[model samples]
Target: DVGCGYEAARQMRRRGRIAPQHWPHVVAASRRLGIAGVSYEWLAGRAAMQRAAVMQGEAA
Candidate 1:
């Protein structure tokens, strides 16, 4: 059965046997936690959205 590749990547990293391909998935894995990610533009967009939301809240 298929398993969690990101979890595998994490274990591999802990064991010092990670591969380059595992990086993006691993990085994206904890993105919401802001631990890491592969999307620079996505992060920027999220920041912009949050900023706008805060500004709107202030204007309310």
Candidate 2:
């Protein structure tokens, strides 16, 4: 599906084909790679946990 959409856009370049327009695909790929969906709250919590672990000097 990605390739198909890319090819279709490529074929319509003269009509302003949008490159890198497959954001959903990119997000899916990122999620599949064990990437964290981080937010400010999540990051703060994670940092706190890590800091606590480091302060204790044990495996987090």
Candidate 3:
């Protein structure tokens, strides 16, 4: 769950050109999960989530 969350955050950070507060949460989760690196493919898919959130006027 954290890997997916981190990837989503990473994508959002890139698209918005702003670091999110949750980044620290993501990092902490990554350490706990022991993932080597976040998956780019997973991160890329976050664009869809971002778009959907925006359309719904909700946080991504």
The prediction achieving the highest lDDT against the true structure is: 3
Q: What shift in Å separates residue 26 of candidate 3 from its native position after superposition?
A: 0.2
lDDT of each: 0.57, 0.53, 0.58
**Candidate 2 deviates by what RMSD?**
15.1
| Per-residue lDDT of model 2, residues 1-60, tens digit only | 334465676775654422345445544555677667733444456557756877888653
- What are the TM-scores, per candidate, against the unseen true structure? 0.39, 0.33, 0.31
Question: Candidates ranked by lDDT, best first?
Answer: 3, 1, 2
The residue-by-residue lDDT of candidate 3 on 1-60, one tens digit each, is 433566776886677722444445555676688966644444445646766778889643
Give the winner by TM-score. 1
Candidate 1, residue 58: Cα displacement in angstroms equals 0.1
**What are the per-model C-alpha RMSD values against the true structure?**
12.6, 15.1, 9.8
RMSD of 1: 12.6
Candidate 1 C-alpha lDDT tens digits along 2-45: 13566875786585543445445545665645764446455456
The local lDDT score (0 to 100) that residue 56 gets in candidate 3 is: 88
Among residues 3 or more apart in sequence or in different chains, the pairs in candidate 3 whose N, CA or C atoms overlap within 3 Å are none
Worst 10 residues of 3 by lDDT: 17-26
Candidate 3 regions exceeding 4 Å error are 1-19, 38-60
